[model samples]
Target: MTDLHRRNPYRLPVLLLIALSTVVGLSILWEFRLEAWVMHWLALPYDADFEDAERWRFVLTATGFSLISMLIPTIMLRRLIANTRSSYRRLKQAQAKTETLATYDSLSGLINRRIFMEMVRNQLGLKRPAAVMLIDLDHFKAVNDQHGHAAGDIVLVEIARRLEAIADDNGGVAVRLGGDEFCLLFLKFKHQTELGQIAEAAVFQLSAPLSSAVEPSALGATIGISRSWTDAQDASALLHCADTAMYRGKKDGRSTYNFYDSEYEKQRRAQADLELALRRAVEADEIVPFFQPIVALPSQEVVGFEVLARWPKPDGSTAAPADFIPVLERLGLIPAMTRSLIKQACRAANRWDDHLRLSMNVSAGMVTDALFPDQLLEQLRQEHFAFHRFEVEITEEALVGNLEVARQNLSKLHEHGITVALDDFGIGYSSLYHLTRLSIDKIKIDRSFFEPGQTDHLPMVEAILGMARSLKMQVTAEGVEEFHLPHLPSWLANSGCNYAQGYLYGRPKPASSLFCYTHSSFAQQAG
Candidate 1:
């Protein structure tokens, strides 16, 4: 039983003692001249005959009624006091629970962001030697996605336990900063090397595979360490520095730790500014499609043009794809950008010869998306582009990333007469598996194999051509610059390379130049 329940037996005794005390005190007061004062005040006969039976009975009755009235109120007041005490105890418990809920994570039982920041501020004000380590679980979403959220929760709870243990060993505090992110605050650390050791331990401990994880290999962490005195002057700044370092660790391939560096902060700011600018540029349609001719081997007849993105700047210069393409992918703008490019490229291709086709690159994310093929078809239909005239160039990495999704998307494209070519073929792993299994129409040999004077790749190229011919799929040799032609064209054609494209034909140009280039004699002369 609770304390309140145990105290119930004392309630009645307490009430009885209070009543007895009141009665005794009243009797004492009456004996001490209080009765005489009361009788004189009321002008009552104090010296009246007490021996008379009728008068004695009247006085006895009044005394009995007075005692009864006093006892009743005393009993009520005692019960009231007991009730107030019980209520106060309950209130204290509830307040404690509320404070706990507010200051700590309900699942992990660790201090939350609010309490963590407050504690950090106190430590800083005291000028105590301290450090903060920010940890992010790598590929944590796969746990939720594949094993269900229940399993994900179990994994998170386990991680919190490990973090708490680490913090306890180091004389620090562990915090759940929400989701898969956690923080450790160390107040007793003496040097940067001590913080690094702790961070290394954190990465090693957190990266250990969990029983509840769907992909055990994916269970890992990236830790970023920041010292209070050197990294920042305040709690938020310290956290930001750690966060910056954490992302840097993730960028450097994860399962690692990074200490706060001023250079990383500068790069982070620059990337942020560029991301903002790229978002605006995409929304404004400043990034447009440029066409590079893809010619049939030997004949050199322009078969189609591969669409490349070119960002036209305000100063009449174009931004390089190397500068902006990665940013687009990071911002998740590639899908929208790809769709827009498709429509523009289709419109431009319609102005060229009817036989010429248009091909555009799709990122791994786009290929994995279940809705991308349908969306691409809808865009093509809106532009009055024939399915046969549209092609998609996907990298080998996309194929290996998720074979099932890639198969589904490629199947849909093939069903609609949309060509699928595996781009940058030789650089990826398991190239032959994709070629034999997937319903691919063509394979574009990566440019690396075609670098001038690179005779060592010639045998590899021949092997790829032989494999393509055996599989009854078309082959396109990329990076056919002037240095590699006219001998390269004849050699590739003899080796069964069905198509080629490079600067020798023409650099990627505006839509207006595509028609003239297709009809130009230079295209035929390259044959």
Candidate 2:
């Protein structure tokens, strides 16, 4: 049917026309008879000699009234049909809008995950060479948290536009897979090099500064590329390959692209499995604190212990913190893990001498948490742990992003009589700044400075000692292996380095083993 008939169906108009035509024809056919009957019934004059003009006028008036009465219903029906047609059109438009919304991302106007995956499945069925890339924005949550989500949204929109343009130019498809994550699918690619070049271009484009109302922020993108022929034959597997590569790109540092490799994929699967196991370990309280003694220099007497997390497998082998800590941080599980470990450490510290301090490392997320100080204090209180005997160790890297907030949190810890130590000092760019800005009570010189044959680093170490002395902050020389102790120069002891900790002093021991050294004679023997 044509547009007009579609808008207003012919059935209603045809029925009304037929009814109106029938009424008019019948009225005309019996006009004189009906008029005479009406006049006789009303007892009005119906003389044979009546004027022709009067009689004709009466007949015409009667026929016109009958036609008007029939046309009223037709006009009403026509109006009802027009209204129904309008509502139907609107309903269809609304449904089309809803479908568009379901398939497209509202913020970026890119194809959503569902539609993109469907397209990928179709492409995979062709069994032809193609490339899939996963793109993730690095440190995007910081932008949203610092500048507000509006600024983050602007950045996302800009990145989406760039990706869409690039994909269109290359005859590819771009999709937003969620916050700060996107996917690009290229159905026709000659070689991996072509895909690599396209991925590189996307990274470069995304690395540009994003303009926002709050402020301009520098953001970088990491892209992971996977080829259909080499990576996988299915859509889900292809996307997984790309995702795995993207994470590797992130680990290698942002603003880069990485192609899928079997080795990396294997490592990725292992890491994923380890993460799952770690989560279970956290829930089951399998993560325990192992204490490494921090000794007073020269005397070799244990004055305090630094608590370290150890995840012991069922087979009695322990997973190294280096292997699982990053995963915890990435998954935002560090805060919960830290809280659990802190309580355990505080309880264990109760078995030690009041003068022997217990030190625990604080993750970046914990320090940023506004309630961290309160939580720590509450845990200590519940454990009946003395605040003065507790030290909180934080890395310089943790305080990089929000220095003011970290400083505030550190100040609160200091106010509660808890010692704040800067762990792995002299490594990060903001070391000096942290020393000046934060209320740090101790600085642990990194082990890198203590490596043998590194006389060049002695001067820097001495400088760090001097700076710490000037600030009246205690200093700990770390990485004091047994082999290096004899080679340790007298300056370290004389320069007022308050403590030393490493394998030389003793490896990290469980709380049960540490109890063996709790007696006063152990300190006397070591001294």
Candidate 3:
């Protein structure tokens, strides 16, 4: 212990008591002793009988001294009391302010997640009917991106005000559960329809334009509601159910609301399972690249292979790319998975004829990464693979929100002789616009146009081929799977298309299969 603390643990209280006693003693002595001293100085006994004039003088002098002594101490004591009360009030105010900071959101002036959870527990303890509405703001990031974070904060504050007003009308409480997410707890409600109406009103209120100063496009909310009896009785479970429903609403289309449904929960669990399996698959290297040949139409020469992801099961079956690719993209696992696949494919392709190129597809999320091009180049360097022997295939969706970043990254790759192909072309609304902006070396017409029963596919194909020719970009007709028909290959070759890829050429096969094909006479012919 420090010497100061060691001297006296209650040192402050002890000194305070001594000071109070000294003040009291001094006041008592001044009121009594000082007047007696005056009497002694005048050589008069304080209680002695005297003539009328002398008695008046003594009485007035004694009363004046007593009044003066009492007044001084009384004023000091009153001042001290007032200061103590004032200090106490100020301390209380500080404590209340601290509590407010702890329990409420400073930006929105609503209860924070901590307080919301506590309130949920309290309501659950009461065993009363209540519901939790989870609200997620749609396109909130776009506002932050386009206008700046200060504008986003203003939007959140205004949203909180509207939510608070609605919660008050419904006898509920509103909470800001961190960025762009909020919750409402309804303690009084009759039926599900009432909650639905309240949710609709909330959506409408939140979607209205804020002011003339800030013009953001379609800032809205998606609300998911869960009840005490039907969905969940506990706080965490209730929130989970509401979150599941909210996500479903978001996936279906934003700016709407959904009530808790068992199907959403099931899907949530299934997705969770798939995500776990995919993570394991990525870690265990079970997800590998299977190459499908892209052939020069009419010549039937294998120019390159489009690398596809295959997750092999123990039963010799494989999971479809459609089933797990979206999960990988959503979990931000695409870059890691893609990197692994690139390493494996590059090592395999490095042993193949140098004339053959490997085209690998990248996810939309991967294109947004500023360092992705450098990372891929570095991986190729580590594998001793030439940049010109590799190609990147990205769907039109990859160019949506990250056009500039994608352009920058793709340009870097193109500079290093890595070709960039706009995959799934003619499908997105802005494919033509993307072709003009991005560093696109080729365009792959979407396979959907060539599906069976697409009778008018010829016109669309002709238009795309004409555009590609005008731009001096190579065209690849995808899903030309009917090679048995002699006219299909001739039509594609005569239409000024450079390549075609689908089941008609060959299904995606393993690396070991390529070792034999590379040695065959057909491989020499394609070469």
lDDT of candidates 1 onward, in order: 0.85, 0.83, 0.84
Candidate with maximal TM-score: 1
Q: List the residue pairs that clash in candidate 3.
A: none
- Cα lDDT for residue 21, model 1? 67
Tens digits of per-residue lDDT for model 3, 1-527: 22443466576446555655565556555444665677889998785343557645555565556656665775676577667768988999999999998999999999999888888878888987779999999999999899899988988988899999999998899999999999998876459889899999998988898863666988899999999878888988889999999999999989999999998689788988889989999988889999998887667778788999998887899887887888887888888899989999988988888888899989888887898899989999999999998999999778887899999999999999999999889878998888889899999998888877675888889889998999999998888785435667688899899998888777898887775244233336435
For candidate 1, lDDT tens digit of each residue in 1-527? 23543568676557666866666566655645477688989999887343456544655565577668876886786677778878999999999999999999988899999998998898888988668899999999888888888888898899999999999998889999999999998876558778888889988999887755344466899998888878897989999999999999999999999999999899889989889888988887778999988988777778888999999888898897998998898788998788778877888777777777898889998998899889999988899999999889998778767889889999999999999999999998888888877879999999999887788999999999998889999998889998876789899988888999999888998897644445544445455
Off by over 4 Å in 1: 1-57, 92-116, 122-130, 134-189, 197-223, 250-257, 279-284, 296-303, 313-317, 326-333, 364-373, 395-416, 422-449, 454-475, 490-499, 512-527
Ordering by TM-score: 1, 2, 3
Cα error, candidate 2, residue 437 (Å): 10
Which window of ten consecutive residues has the lowest lDDT sum in model 3? 516-525
